[model samples]
Target: MHTPLSDQLRILLGPVDLADIDPGATPGAVSHEQTEDELPKLAARLDDLQRRLFAAAQGGHSTRRVLLVLQGMDTSGKGGTVRHVVGQLNPNGIRLTAFKAPTEQEREHDFLWRIRRALPEPGEIGIFDRSHYEDVLIARVRKLVPPMVVGRRYQLINRFEQQLTAEGTVLVKCFLHISRDEQMRRLLARLDDPTKRWKYNPGDVDERALWPEYQEAYRRALEKCSTDEAPWYVVPADHKWYRNYAITRLLIEALERIDPQYPPGDYDVEVERERVLASG
Candidate 1:
């Protein structure tokens, strides 16, 4: 039997608790294996839920906006998650932004200036491929900024997210939790496949050298910013199919919670064959 939306959502919204998982584990290394036959059913269920969300969003006015932030180490499937999980959303109401290293002009401004510019307008959904959390993740991992400044950014981010939620944005942050082994598997695949060679970067190896520091950075980011208004859901990314299913399920629930409604209208009885009843 297919799982109910409420139960699926509960599992999706439950604590990520990465501390309990091994740092060096692969995506599916520790979890129970799923049978290949189960994938089609799971995919179909996600597609059905996504269709409902789109219908609700088309009619409902209460859903102001949704901002989904995706953060993870290279090969953790941030781009892939975006591709599969939200692939079917109504494009007219969605925006995707990918953040990279700062330009000279961007470097001159405050860290958040660019981020603020990318926020979606009311009634839209914004997906960030990488985000301001870069301020904490990259800066902390490489010591690029002062320790004091970096440490303070955590609370600043929490307050910033809370303010966004207060103002009508629904924020969902996801950290793709992939084990080192799974990362290496993906990294090697990138190198080995000619079609995927474009994704391989020498800098990835450099980052792998500082894996421990990145792990600490992620730990602190989750601990500090997972708040009531904008919480983080760390999806286990070893099994790409499961990761996509989990994220899509969570998003459908959030959209449903908004309960979009159609504008009121009356049927035109004069144009219909059936007789219209007179109002009292």
Candidate 2:
């Protein structure tokens, strides 16, 4: 059974020492024994709560926007979380943006221009599959860019996120930390299964060889980017199902705090009741 949200989250958001997490350890599958084998039930509860929060947000005339940034190595369930966790949200109020390799126009602009363009409007949730931190994480890992440039980018990202938070956008960054061995298992499974083969990339193996480098990059990324306004949550992702639960729970808590509500009725209470009775 899964841990109740209250219990599970008490552990999930506690202090994490990056040095103690072994990137090479093997993570097992998620268990539902405690949750009555009802992953769907838990997920549904989260969805319903989110909708209520959205309605409350609209009602309260709240301008808060939520930006959920997800980062992880390949096969860490970033795509799956997007498909499952946020899939049931009201499409009108949520925006899902995947930051891919820069296009010609995007590359011509500053690194943050595309991201700025994708920011969520008032009372909306914006999810970035991979976000501005990519410049720091991937670039530092591969040494694809100059050292000076990477250093500058990290500072820029921190300032960028700070600005967003200061402007009423609640930023939540999550790093999906998966074990090296489990990653290899998932990668191989993708290759062996024809239906799942599409997820495999030849570059995944190449990147697997640099697991240590990636870990170092992640350590630094979290160290530099986690802040009072825009904190980073490093989730243990060996178990995809647990990862999903953690994500849904995180979002639920955040939305509940925002406490979105429907707009008040414009009509007088007595008149409104009379109108309802007349219509009936």
Candidate 3:
């Protein structure tokens, strides 16, 4: 059964048309001010949840971890989301990997090899800036791989995620949905501001030309790979504040469901306390 939270975020577990989602839409009439006001509270809750999850793992009571896979086109605020939403948590418990173009060494192995190595440990939360989905997304759009190979990768990804979930890793895949117009605006903004110019890539304009193809590739990937254990959520990211709020809410709700609790001490608590008291 879908939780109310899942339904609220339009979590994608099946077929979905990218065109159907308005990138500017927010849940209900939520305002940017409201979202900003609530963000700290949600972030606090997320921090507590993360601590409990880590504590459980330290005590050898939790094998479950969280993997947050963030995917979006250029200028969709992937960096901003990481900064505002995920930045609140304890850095020690967070494992962040920003996937770049595969190295020659990485290319030699199957797509999942590097990704598998980066998976969060039992107590940690792993954040993938761009993940194995690139094998299907950019590879499909750029024809980096044969169609038959890309087709096979979808199945491989699903099986890989299934294995992760079976072994106790929770997955939250988010597509930071932004419209073409908004993307162009952001790209142009990057060019206009000297400080942001470093973020501007001439290659982004080249990719922008292939926007439709990328969208289709993303659509297919999201539809085919969203499983019960690892569903994808389309986050309307045109409004940065709302995007942070929504993603933070989704994460808090997910952790609540997991309900990680600090494990009891293995040794006798009273004896340990008495020993400490005597030493003092």
Candidate 4:
């Protein structure tokens, strides 16, 4: 029996050590050409499931929803995954939000307030390019909040996620694990290509200097917040194809598990057909 990729990539029980796994590699023996070939099949399946989810919600048959939480270091291909993977799903059912530095108004509220506003409604698939975890990750790394405050947000996040799942949201949390060496190469390439230079940030190099700190932040976040309701999956991301493939598989699995059933038509099909014919 083929083991689901979720079991392989998910951090079920761990003190997350990012160094233990190779970011350049994948959990499966699948090849790049194979992944490319398999994506269309995955997309087609995902499309059918997503449409079922949307259709179910339209008839009030289900309140099912999906939320894909993506977190990673700079140049870890979060955006790339969205373009390559999420773009394959129906745009009408997607609600995407890329969280950035908190605005002054946003800072006035609790960390999760903005997150709650961006959550997917019934039958929609929500994508968070970065998320509430920032309250613990960067907030701890940069000392944006007090150490004690950072300590508390972990439990807060866990409770929040638990409540979401209780209300029928399937949460797929992914940490795009990339290596330092690969990140340096990509940074250099960004500077080398004029079209990409716009994405190059001098601050990125400064952030790179604090790599160890950031990794520790990630470890703490994963350790404290990864729960049965919302487990974290470490996606090997040095290989762009594998990262995309892994995430696509993760989404497919989550939706399949939901197994949304399209509701029966409220009106008789034959009557509808006759009414349509007479109207014509």
Clashes of each: 4, 13, 0, 0
Better of 3 and 4 by lDDT: 4
Q: Rank the candidates by TM-score, best first.
A: 4, 3, 2, 1
Question: Model 3 off-target regions past 4 Å?
Answer: 1-3, 11-14
TM-score of each: 0.79, 0.83, 0.96, 0.97
TM-score for candidate 4, please give it.
0.97
Q: What tens-digit string does per-residue lDDT give for candidate 2 at 11-119?
A: 2334445557654332332454543365567567666665664665676655777888889989998999898777757777898899898889998888899999999
lDDT string for model 3 (53-134, tens) is 9999999668988898999999998899899888888999999999999999999999999999999999899999999999
List per-prediction Cα lDDT, in the order shown: 0.74, 0.75, 0.88, 0.92
Which 10 consecutive positions of candidate 3 have the poorest summed lDDT?
1-10
The lDDT, on a scale of 0 to 1, for candidate 2 is 0.75
Q: Is candidate 2 or candidate 3 better by TM-score?
A: 3
RMSD of each: 5.5, 3.9, 1.9, 1.1
- Lowest lDDT block of 10, candidate 1: 4-13
**Who wins the TM-score comparison?**
4
How many Å off is the CA of 93 in candidate 4?
A: 0.1
